[model samples]
Target: MKRLMLDGPGALRWEDAPEPTLDAPAQALVRPVALATCDLDPAVLQGRFPLAGPYPFGHEGVAEVVAVGEEVRTVRPGDKVVVPFQISCGACGPCLRGNTGNCAAHPLMSSFGLGPLGGLDWGGLWADLTRIPHADAMLVKLPDGIDPITVASASDNIPDAYRAVAPQLAAYPGAEVLVLGGPAAPSIGLYAAGLAVALGASRAVYLDTDPERLSIAAKLGAEPIEGAPAERVGRFPIVVEAAGGSKALIAAVRATANDGWCTSVSVQAKDTALPMLEMYSRCCTFHTGRAHARPSIPHVLDLVATGRFDPSPVTTRTVPLADSIDALLEGPVKLVATN
Candidate 1:
């Protein structure tokens, strides 16, 4: 099989690799039917973060269960499933509390496509085949009649977006939401905005320099704000920073309402100064952590199945596995590579 490997910063290559098989009772062997890049991949490739090279290069994909171990009964061979970015064992304490991202039974770090995790740098789904651990806990079967391309984002982006707004929904019902960033065509932001609306948000504002992305946000019922940091303006009770930039981060904090909440999905390597005095005075609550993808995947998928959310519009292009690298390097929105 062929897989995308990161040789160094701004460097991506497709190389031959061994096929993956079930390595444990809770594992399953899956053949990717479709895969897409996360919003953070390009930034990591550009060395904007502390990511090291020669690692697996993708973390989002939809696949078919080709085989499963004895302990895996939730899904069977031929079932289509969404694979989350984080690998976790279902029985752990963290997992029981719906925190699958920090599952304790797995390796201390088991993230896909990154070496920071202490486990086998589990390569991403930008390949013909991949291994899924704790199969019953990690894979979510796609709903009947839903396009595989549409649900690809559910593997990571959609769930991550949902997590960004989950903590704020109860406190600020119908509160305004401001999303910062325009990656994978403002995918993370757009998904979150849609979720917020579904959850009864009164308004969802999206800020991005890209006109195309802003247009998409508008179509999804969000008010689009365009321009640079100086030109962009808005104040919201819940702000989500997905832009992955220092200026965007600062703007999100500055624009948040008093006693508001700001959720950050962007990963920045550089140190950023915060308005501590301002935040203190305003009584703002800021939360930053990895999205517990596995646990959130099911609910997001159900929403998609019920027609409450549609991620298909975010896909700008779809290519074959052979063109995965090119798809990763250039795209304004979601790009899927199919086998």
Candidate 2:
């Protein structure tokens, strides 16, 4: 089997590797049919992230169940499914509480494809075949009518964006949403804004410095603001910070209405300062962490299957697996590679 291996920053190659086999009755083997570039991929490839590679490089995709172990009953050979980025056992205390990202049964941050952060032993979705433990718990069968490419990011980005807005909107009921977008997780920001609109937010306003991001946001039905405002954009009950810098995070926090909630999906490698006094005065709730992707997969799939949400517009290009290396090097907003 051959898989995409990240030799170093901006260096990748197709390398032959041993095929993965199911070692446990609860495990399964899958062949990735559609792989998407995670927003973090470019950073990892470009050396912007603090990671040393020479490991399998992808974590988002839809796959075909090539084989299943005896204990796997939810799916069988030939079933198409969304393989979550994280590796988690569904019976742990944290998983039972809906924190699959912090499942007590696995090492902290045990996942696929981020090298050390995500266990290297688990490999990546860019491979020909990968093993998935806790098959029924980790794999979400793609709904019959949904296109696999449209929800390729359902494994991570879509669910990350979904968490940034859906629950907040549900709690606030028809309130407006504010999305701060830029380099980090750009597609996630667009997805968040789009979900807000599709889920019935009174209005979804997206702020970003990049014209391309603003354009995509507008196409997703959100009001696009060209430049970052000097002060608060507007008081909103739900604010999402998908932009990477401290400036954007500050803006997002300050822009929240009294008692509002602001969820940040950005990755900041260093410890940064925050406006504690303002948050104290505003009484805002701030949340920032890794997305517990598994539990949200089914809901996101339902959104796509029911025609309530469409994530296809965010995809910048579609290329076959052979062309994935070039597509990944180009680093578009969202690139989906089909096998």
Candidate 3:
């Protein structure tokens, strides 16, 4: 099998690797039929994250079940499915609570791809064949109506955006959402704006300099604002900071309305000074963390199947496996690399 191996930052190659076998009774072997990048994948490619080289290089996509474990009943051979990035057992305490990212049975940061985070070693999804453990919990059987290439992000980014804003809308009807976004955040920020509008937000505004992102947001019914995040003072009741820059994070915090909630999807390592005083004064609630993608999959998928939430606009290009390594290593949000 040929897999995308990351030798170093911005360095990728097609390497021959043994096909993954079903390693456990609950595991399954699936062939990647449609591959794409998650929000953090681009950052990993550019070396922004502390990832050592030589590992499978992607974690977003839908797969065709080549084989299934004896215990796996939800899906069968030849079934196409979406695998969430996080490695979690649905039977765990945290997963039962809809926080699959923090499974109590695994290491704190247990996940597929992103090599060796805290000593957990699951390979990437950019391969011909890959193993999926806890198949029933880890895989979402792709519905007949959804396109695997387009909904490739359903494994991570699309669902993350759904998780970020769906609850907020449910909690506060007609809420206003402000997405402190940039081109680096990928389609996630745009996905959030689209979800907010579809889920009944009073107003959804996307702030960014990228014409492409802004155009997508506008097409999705969001009011696109062209400016720097730091220059904005519009206090939104619900704010999402998908831009990984420190300035954008700070501005996101600063723009939260009193008693409002700000959810930051950016995964940054360095510390940046935030407007703690202002946030404290306003009694604002701020949250920064990894998304719990599995639980939200059903709702998001329902929306996708019904055409209520379209993932097509998120993808800029679709390439074949032979030419996918470069696309995986660089440029454009939501590049769909199909088998």
Best by TM-score: 2
**Which runs of model 2 end up more than 4 angstroms from their true locations?**
229-231
lDDT of each: 0.78, 0.90, 0.84
What TM-scores do the predictions have? Answer: 0.92, 0.98, 0.95
Model 3 segments beyond 4 Å from truth? 118-120
Compute the lDDT for candidate 1: 0.78
Model 2: per-residue Cα lDDT over 82-131, one tens digit each: 99999889998999988999989889998888898887888999989999
Candidate 1 per-residue C-alpha lDDT over 270-332 given as tens digits, one digit per residue, 9 for 90 to 100? 788988898999888887767888878888888788987777767778888786666667644
**Can you give the lDDT of residue 64 in candidate 3?**
95
Residue 72 in candidate 3 has what lDDT?
93
Off by over 4 Å in 1: 116-119, 183-185, 230-232
Error of 3 at 107 (Å): 2.1
Ranking by lDDT: 2, 3, 1
* Cα deviation of 98, candidate 2, in Å: 0.8
**Which has the greatest lDDT?**
2
